[model samples]
Target: MLTCVTRGLFIQLVFDCRRLRKMQPQQPGYSSSRAYLELIADLPWQKVSEERELDLRAAKESLDRDHYGLTKVKQRIIEYLAVRKLKPDARGPVLCFVGPPGVGKTSLATSIAKALNRKFIRISLGGVKDEADIRGHRRTYIGSMPGRLIDGLKRVSVNNPVMLLDEIDKTGSDVRGDPASALLEVLDPEQNKTFNDHYLNVPFDLSKVVFVATANRMQPIPPALLDRMEVIELPGYTPEEKLKIAMKHLLPRVLEQHGLSSAYLQIPEAVVKLIIERYTREAGVRNLERNLAALARAAAVKVAELDSTLRLGKEMQPITTTLLDSRLADGGEVEMEVIPMGQDISNTYENPSPMIVDEAMLEKVLGPPRFDDREAADRVSSPGVSVGLVWTSFGGEVQFVEATAMAGKGDLHLTGQLGDVIKESAQLALTWVRARSADLNLSPTSDINILESRDIHIHFPAGAVPKDGPSAGVTLVTSLVSLFSNRKVRADTAMTGEMTLRGLVLPVGGVKDKVLAAHRYGIKRVILPERNLKDLAEIPAPILAGIEILLVKRIEEVLGHAFENGFPLRLHSSL
Candidate 1:
């Protein structure tokens, strides 16, 4: 049976064909109407059926073969495929892969397409500010065309293609409209069955299409749009996983591209590890692949040079018997005649000297390491400085909070592009410190007088990068206490938690990311809110093993764990 849309389009095409037949051959409307009729005829009205069964085993193998270290993402895709196999007509939820760049989010989507035996289409939503770019411009406008969704279907000539909306978080909005808001109707499975494009002027069935979106961060995505999709997180790779990926996938491909074999150019395990640790630091192998390609190009040049030298007839002379005897005899005892014994060096060109990329070679090729944790460690080694862990869009990072006091009017200065929440946190921390100065051993005389006579300044480094959130509450308080009492915080310690007015440590989000950040910075100890202890389960065991995790319910407990000594003797006695 013909659907309403098909019935209407057929009727319209019949009328247009009759009108075009009557019109003159060279008339503009005649040719245009004929073309429109052909387009309407070619529209794919019927849904294509997958004759082959959904193969879970083959799908798993394909995903594993294409990508590495996205175990949870692969599992989720497999589960979806399994459910899909059981119920063919079920509409799957839209999957959004969230991670930093080069972590295989885009490639994973392609792998999904291959697994399901569907055509893949990619539409980058980055910098797409106009809503028309998504829903498409109306027919009333000049040069109007179908939206990306409809266009993708037309190009693939199928209804069940895997459509990837890459960089969804980067979609922009202005006076035109919100492109992200336009995606709400398209992403929601219930509404997408009759997905309407403005130019198409007909309801297109998008229920069968598998929509996957990728983003570096989730915060920029509209909440309504975010709610429609199931998010799968792909965190940064571990050193071991990175090395494996390089050896398994990247090395051979790079070798083949450079026209060199692994025998002629070898990258040892230690060298690959050095490349990962020093040359590039990212959650994915994009940069790692680039580094490997560079190494391959360098090796290719050496091979080319060796081949050129051999072709130029530059052969080494073999040592004569007289020369060997002269070398064996005493320095001034024998005289030897030097003669050229021609030995073709061309054979050596067949097996070029293997290029071994070590730590020193990596330095020469990729320049110095991008990050240095030692400088950060030394900066936070003194009193009035404390380390705070933060979660950013790129990934987790360690931020240093520094506080200093001087004799002046009782004014507190806050710098470092701190957000309002963080500024409020700093103020609250200062108030808490002032109120408890007597117990904290921060005041030699009256607490009020000590605070009133001094000016306190708190600053977070990296002044250009905006810092926010309530998570820095404990770190700020510790910095204040250390500044006032002349006690240094533990150099290897880091803390993250919100502070209440009554000295309670409140829970903060991103515990796993913050802990990972701390671990990356070589922090030996971490103080977190007791409520976030469950988040520790999400972190890997190896990362957790290196750090001492102290779950604290109150600010005093944080102080005890953060400082080198459990607090000052006087404060300890008072407690």
Candidate 2:
């Protein structure tokens, strides 16, 4: 019995050793196991300390100090931290800041890291297509390596760092598999605890790491991936906010970079406002910053010239007296004096005036305004042309809807690269007008006869840009009405809303964005759906104060507000 037991034990021991050898990490020939062991030991585990109450206070201070505005975002982040402190076991919510480029989305992540006392790592997801980029390639493949998440952790030397995944919406997909789908696992709190990388082939804890994402447009982001994140919207700054940002953050940074000071170069608030309104019409201060840098560069050149002239003047002080005497000979010289090159013959050299960047200086520095609202306004002054508000990924813009009638087989032609939704909207508008021809007094003949007599051509000004969405329904209807009735749309009016076959106006999304776009174009009166009146509360008070908002529940109301003298109607014998 003892001999049999000994044999069995020997066999078991051999089997165990074979399994152990197979499980060992693969390495190049002639490399010792000690190197691999050292690498594992070198991997950083807990680089950041546990979240503490005091860190929250520090975080708020850091955020406020580094960033301007975004009060709501700051409060939301603080609330997140407070929740994290209360629930230590829970993973942090993945925050995705949606806004235009250069709006401090990436910078805010860095600020969050500084607040929490953690290392920061950023991975640009722009154009990242392969799934291997997120989950890592298998070691079986040559040139195999870990994914960005793992690499970021390795570089930071910590398991828990603030990782910012930027431009998530820009990620592409192909046969290689979707990187966005792979991110779902990494971003999920439940699955990330045992996150198994292909190369590592072992579970690595990623639950402690905090991930933040950013994107310019939300629609391009995969719905499944967006679901895992708590979205925070950062709208384009208002004129006042932009000015404050320029004065508080952008001005100082640009001035220091150009080696100039406020004492030497003075940019008044009025000049900043002019730059904001004319030179740059963006949601963020990126263009504004660039313009300021240009101004700074121009100012730097002047300063350098002034400095060089002063140096030259000091060197030629003795010669200056002789030159002044000779030059003053024609004017009857009373005394021999030396004047600086920066100063003329007058004594105005003692107190030099600061270079003021006014409207004229702005025009000189930035050339003419890139965006001319007057041209846009003039385009909509004629009949059959109406102003429509559109929300783009960059920001809000005013789109012109133009229509004209000609004698043909009643075919409706749409010239713009309009999508299915907008094409359908245009058709619906025509249908509603034809059905209600008697009520509208469109013509003495039947509605079908009127449409059959002439062909209508509708064109959106910018045919190159793809336009879609149902929000332009009201605008299209108003445009068609104005075309048939020979009435001009009010030049100061802009409209946005969806319309049903029954002439009922429906509310649309991006109300704030649309309103801001109208405000940017200097529209005095805006026609919006009655339901969207609630959304107006979110708009800036200053923007709302300037424009007249007419809330309408039906298409008739829109027509009333759109035209200077409502829709012209011809009296019928039945009336």
Off by over 4 Å in 2: 1-42, 49-52, 55-58, 308-353, 445-447, 568-575
lDDT (0-100) at residue 402 of candidate 2? Answer: 97
TM-score quality measure for candidate 1: 0.86
Instruction: Write model 1 residue lDDT over 154-260, tens digit each, in one string.
Output: 77777788899999999999999999999999988888888778866667788888899999888889889999999998777666778899999999999998899
lDDT of 2 at 240: 85
Stretches off by above 4 angstroms in model 1 are: 1-6, 13-43, 47-51, 308-348, 406-408, 444-450, 569-575
TM-score of each: 0.86, 0.84
- Per-residue error for 288 in candidate 2, Å, reads 1.3
lDDT of 1: 0.82
RMSD of each: 7.3, 8.0
